[model samples]
Target: MNEIFVKSLPLKDVIANIAEALDTTYFNRCNEYILNIPEIYGEGSIRGINFLNGFGLIEYNCTLKEALKIHFNVNSIHPLKFIYCSKGSVKHKFEEHDVLHQIEQFQNIIVASTQQNGHILIFPKNENIHLNSLEISRKEFKTKIDCDLNILDVGLKKLFKDLTARNLFFYQGNYSLAMSDCIDTIKTSKFSGIARSLFLEGKSNEILSIQISDYEDDKKDIPKRQILRKSELVQIQKAVQILKSELSKPLTIKELANKVGTNPTKLQEGFRYNFGLTVNNYLNKIRLDYAKEQIMIGELNISEIANNIGIANKSYFSRLFKATFQLNPKEFSLQIAKNANKRQRNRPLT
Candidate 1:
């Protein structure tokens, strides 16, 4: 196992420390630090960005050849950490605690070690580990003009105000689908310069707020919070049925979302989580499947088939059909007709 100690304060120093320990180097872009893993070590990179108000984002996407242990041993009051495992599981243990927590895919954990204590993150060997950590320095966070920590509810106020780390804090639960989208945006962000800095900072703040809300909802034991509610499932099913029944009519995502009594965001998420396809893609699949069935039935020509399956243009339908099945709709339909005629001719006299 390889052990890397990050004895630093901010993201820049932390990334620099890792890069140095591995005998490689890191680069800086608009205050964001990126450490590309040396080929001798593994394939992947560790990147991080820090905002002025003490919030930071660290992304680790890697498949290391051996087990790696990253120890954050910064002294003084350590930064609060909101860690989310997006792809693979990771093991974590506070320096002051013996219990190790495993954060699996789609799960998050909020951890704050006691004063001068630190965090241990363990990534198993040869696994695709992808996670993001939102770190906030409470002492510095309180100084932000808009912080207004006192206005926050009692529990969050106390949790954020533990400057001396009087209480060791740790909470774990599945993250919300909305937060998953935010994280995905962070991953796919292409901005640079001031835009990059501002965008990342905004997203980091959003993730933190969602994390807080999720924690509060967890404490309240809200069944409809992070977990998908029955209503949502029913709406998803209803959306599918609507699409199936309206094969000759295409609906916009907004229209579908509205008919289901849900917003576009939730509808999009429902499709992603439950159906594993985008709304438009799923609709197109349904229409094309119906068109195939209609063609195989030998009742409609290509143009009629397209019209019946919500495709106004035969050329477009043909392109989609070819793309999906690698066969022309007209040829496929004629072949079906030919097969039926041949079978009819081969039948024995009754």
Candidate 2:
């Protein structure tokens, strides 16, 4: 495996050190340090930027030609790290430890080395790995104005205030939806220069807040913890596909759960958390939407449309359509026809 060592701090120097180790070079964009992967090795780039509040953001978006390990062995205390894997997987290990922890996609790990013990990150070759690291320089962060009382939990407060790095902390869990949204925003952002830097700085902090909250919620009892996982997301996708494909014969929540290889309760939770509605409601939406499409075609009558979408009673289907769209199926169809006629009448000399 190829190895690169970063022996620096404040993020910018960290990227510079990696560039030197690679025998390559890096560039600066609004104080954001970026090191593009050399063409001889692979494709993509890795970049880092430091904020004034002692928080830093680093993103690795690349597909290397071979396995690689980045060894961070700074002389001083290493910054607390919140590493998130958004695309491919990566492995983590403390420089002084022997055990390695694999962080897969959609997962995160909160780590604090024991008393200057550094960190080693391993990335597999020929994989599209996109990950971000949110680092906090505790020595500087503790002195920032935003690090006030009531901003953190008792243990987290202690963790932040521990400038000596006497304790070793390692936590791994699935990242929250809110954190995912923040990251999505960061990736899709179109800004550049100072605008981009300021925007990312704020979003990075927002992601950190959500990450800490996610950690706190994870510490609670199993029943009270609502953290979503990759398994649930897979189930949700399966459920959606079944609903859309078998529209004329929709299944009950329990039946759908069985079809998707999950329990009814988990299915319901997945629908609510991912789609913002219950399973039954989502099914109804699918049916109603299909009904509208059939209605617009002007081939199926109300009863036929209702039956085509798995609804036996036309009256009940009409009522549902009215409740959701403020217009009964018949009325909506009529409105569609009227708009079509008006447009035809207004047609020009063609």
Best candidate per lDDT, number? 2
Per-candidate Cα lDDT values, in order, are 0.84, 0.86
lDDT of 2 by residue, 96-181 (tens): 89999999999999998977688999999999999999988878887773437457776777788778888888899988667777
What's the distance in Å from true for residue 254, model 2?
8.7
Residue pairs in clash, model 1 = none
Q: What 10-residue stretch in candidate 2 is worst by lDDT? A: 223-232
lDDT per residue for candidate 1 within 60-121, as digits (tens), equals: 99988888899998667889898998888999999888899999888999888887789999
Model 2 residue 260 lDDT score: 80
The most accurate candidate by TM-score is 2
Off by over 4 Å in 2: 145-155, 227-231, 241-280, 290-314, 322-350
lDDT of 2 at 123: 92
RMSD of each: 9.2, 4.6
C-alpha lDDT (0 to 100) for residue 113 of candidate 2: 90
